[model samples]
Target chain A: METTALLRQLSEAVGPPGYEAPVAELIERLWRPYVDELRRDPLGNLIARRRGSGAEPRPVLLLAAHMDEIALLVSGYAEAYGHGYLRIEPIGGIDRRVLLGQRVWVHPRDGEPLPGLIATPPPHILSQSERKKVPPWDHLFIDPGLPIEQLEARVRIGDPITFRADYLELKNRRVAGKAFDNRVSVAVVTLALAALLERTHAWDIVAVATVQEEVGLYGATTAAYGVAPTAAVALDGTFARQHDVGEDEAVALDGGPAIGVGPNFHPYLVDRLKEVAEHHEIAHQIEAIPRGSGTDAWAIQVSREGIPTALLSVPMRYMHQPVELLSLRDVERAARLLTEFIADLRADERPVWEDEHGS
Target chain B: MDFELLHRLTTAFGPSGYEAAVRELIRKEVAPLVDEVEVTPLGTLIAHKKGSGPRLLLAAHMDEIGVIVSYVEDKGFLRFAPLGGIFPLYAIAQRVRFANGVEGVVAVERRKDESKPPALSEMYIDIGAPSREASPIRVGEPAVFVGETVRVGERIIGKTMDDRIGCYLLIDFLRRLRTSRFDLYVAFTSQEETTLSGARTAAFGIEPDMAVAVDVTLTGDTPKALPMAVELGKGPAIKVKDRGMVAHPRVRDAMVEAAEREGLPYQMEILTFGTTDAAAMQLARAGVPSGCLSIPCRHVHSPGEMVDVNDVERAVALLLALVA
Candidate 1:
């Protein structure tokens, strides 16, 4: 698939934290032919294992990217206009400011996907202090653009809703859409797997489209435990260059992927990946995560006994909001860097796992 | 009732992202009873018992809401961020102890007007260090409430009753369980107060047919509190919904059914603010039918968190009924 087309296809797929079947299915289809074995774990992590030609018990190198997106869901309703106006809360992390004037996808029970818009209460109707404050979730409601009675009948509490931001291929190959926070990471993993398929490596590669990562590093934690990989790398989106963000926190967009360095990342893995990025002249940034990276790498690093984990983050702009921006070059670069890193790995030359029991 | 065990668990130095001491205690307690036990990378303890039927995951986080040292000032006062859902209103004036045994008093950053409420960020921990050089605590270290469990007639009060109470129930259940119809996987999870990661991964690894998280729920029986139906001393709360999840219909029915079968008094939980390990468990894999058995707790996430012993015991019984 064309990178932009694939990006749009995955972004448009409605998969909240728990509701990831649509996204998982699309991943399964794209990932099936490239791997030796593929299956979905009990927690809905789509695990695709690309077998190696090495000796028996080939050590696994896992790459995880969460398929779930930050979206909203119906929480409850209050009666008004002879119908229940839907009160909603975010599924993952969403800035309330971005929700203003957003088109939303409401997955209602027993019907077609319903189109909804956040009701922007006019400024004239608001009190002085109320106008200054972005309304709390209690005060926010969605209008599905149906008749009051029909809206009430169509929607129910707990139904999943995603933002309806159409993916835009921007000038200079920058793309904008919702859920680039992770959907693009999946794209990178796909590109890496496709690249790996054309090469030979000694270590097994388990590309896991992990679930419920936006909620926490849930999917990565379990996949780490289940796969018990010798080493793992979580492909995720980091903060892209923005004037408001601190220099220490931001990664330059189009600068390949960020090689993570921090407590969460194994120093050995970090050095190895950094060396490879340098060797290949792959544009990369160094991201410091002194504590938990708030990515799957944090959870995966601490999974049963510990898997030496590294984080490769694509720089993204306007994260957690609709229309998150990304550069396709960074995605392709991360894929190539990871593929080359795996290709360079000798099955016997493992990550620093001897001290897994300690810190 | 093992008040001694409860006392130790409550007083143990275990905060989210740091659960070694708590895990050590739980390992020794349940190691003899469980068929297999292991610790996850995230520091959660998974103890399993074999059975012939479906896999059942029962989870209770061992982590408690605490604070992590974010920055240390020149005078040694530590600025901290909450490891979990902790309100600043209840935290001020409380004592906290770090993993390394350094104790500190929580003090709010001053406001020009004393009447205004301080946000959590506007709080600091004073360990009585004369200067930054004299301080024993380092930035990034975590500290939990310094309190001990006390039995006040039918009630027990302590810190972290929000989850240690649930852990106590699970531990007691593991020791008492004889034969079960389903395979049991009990995860003494970690980082729930912060990440809710332990239960989520444990559930996915076990691939349980159904899951239940045991935790503490807020009660409104206190004077002039919000109009919540859950009351302290009421039997286990069968969760219907919370901030994170709507219980699967079958899981909700199963709890109610078990409660009825055991003739145990149970409240229907509709928590407005807090979420539990069940919320993360339900999201694991394809999705497991999940619900919670909550012990009614008051002053939750505080040093004075209180739970009725009767409620705790009944919660155990209801869980047994579900298992059988």
Candidate 2:
């Protein structure tokens, strides 16, 4: 599948947290030919294990990107004027401020994902106090333009919903549309896995499209424990530099992947990823995460007695909202960095944190 | 099902960052019931009952929001940061208990004239030590709302009901199980009030096919409160959506189906504010379809939080039916 096209579909797919079957299935079909064996773990993690050329029991290098997206769900329904409207609640860390005017896809229980607008009452109908405040996000509702019974018959409560916007390719190789968090990194994982198929590496590679990272790196936790990789690299999106943000806190959009450094990351693994990025001349930034990366690295770092883990971040603008901005070049660089890191891994290598500040 | 257990669970000294006492209590009750148990470094207690392929993660958070000492004053007053979300208005004038059994009262800075409400920075915990050296609570020590689980008529009123009710329900669910149809992993998660982080690791390890959060949620049936559809004593709430997650359709339906099949009293929950472990559970590996069974409680996150005993019982029933 074309990377951009797959991203568009992945972005469009209505796989909310804990409900990533649709997106996982899509990735499975795309990755089936490249990987040796693929299985869905008990936690719904899509684990694609490719044994290394060296040996069957060789150390595993797991590359993970969460396949889930921040989304909405049907919380309650109301009917009036023979028309029914649905109230929604958010699935992940959402900027409720940005939810007021986005077109959305309401995944009904039995039909195709439907198109709707998150409609609100007119300013005239709302109270003065209500007008002054951003109405609580759970108070937001969707209007599917269907009558009461028709709407209820199709869209039941708890069905996952997502932003229904087309992925737009802008000038200068930039792309936008709900790329807010990890779908781009997921695409990067897909691209990297595709690129690795033609190459040989010493160690085994486990390319897992993890689930539920938006909630708290749960997919990576379970998948990492099950995969029991010797080393892991988590791919995620980071905040890009805005005009007001200090350069220290943000990365640039056109920059290559952001190589994360922090307590959650293994210093050695981070050093290796940075070395590979430098060796390959891939554009990248040194991102700092002093305490926690708030990524899958946090869980992967301590999985079942712990695994050495690193993070590759794509610089993204408007994170955790619809229509986030990032350059495709950044994604490609991240994928290349992952492929290079895996190829460079030596079977005899085992690195642990002796002291965070030391070698 | 014992009030004494609920009382002990509710009264256990644990804030978001300090959950040792709470975890120890839950471990004792849950150890004999499960085939395997593991405590993660982040302070989550996970008990597993292995069965079939599709895993089921049952979550109940152990930690509650409280004050953490940020500054110890010469006069022995303690300036603090809230470990989780603590409304300054509700927290002011409330007494708190530290993990080391020290007691204190949250006090707001006094102003010369009648003034607007103060911010958390203006407040201090008064622990009756004359100086910083004499004070038993030091910087970074956590203290929660003074432990008290009171039975006022038929309602259970106390602090930490926001999630101790959840912790209590998970234990009760484990003890009452007849047979496990799916592989069951019950996570007595920590730091849910802070980040929902512990459940993340436990869920990853358990990776159940479906999951449910047993937590307490806000009810709108109070006088002069926001008009919410949920009310105390209506029944256990099967979450539709909250700040963290939208319960998956199949899981939500299964909860509803279980309630209907068992003829259990239940309410459909659409929480406008606050979140639960379901938010973490739903996003755990490949995304196990997850939902929440909330015990409707009034005055959530307040010292005098209230939930009907019947609601707790029904929530246990609804969860049992969903997983079974």
Which candidate achieves the best TM-score against the true structure? Answer: 1
lDDT of 1 by residue, B91-114 (tens): 988899987788999998768878
Listed for each candidate, the true contacts retained, as a fraction, are: 0.09, 0.01
Model 2, docking class = incorrect
Q: Quote the lDDT for A229 in model 2.
A: 82
Scoring each candidate complex against the real one, what DockQ results? 0.07, 0.03
For residues B252-274, could you state the per-residue lDDT of candidate 2 as single tens digits?
89889999999988888888898
For model 2, the stretches where C-alpha displacement exceeds 4 angstroms are A124-129, A353-359, B1-324
Model 2 per-residue lDDT tens digits across residues A118-165: 887889998999988887866788899999898988999999888887
Model 2: per-residue Cα lDDT at residue B233: 85
Residue pairs of candidate 1 with colliding backbone atoms = A42-B285, A43-B284, A43-B285, A44-B285, A302-B41, A302-B42, A303-B41, A304-B41
- Whole-model Cα lDDT per candidate? 0.84, 0.80
Find the 10 residues in a row with the least total lDDT in model 1 chain B.
Answer: B37-46
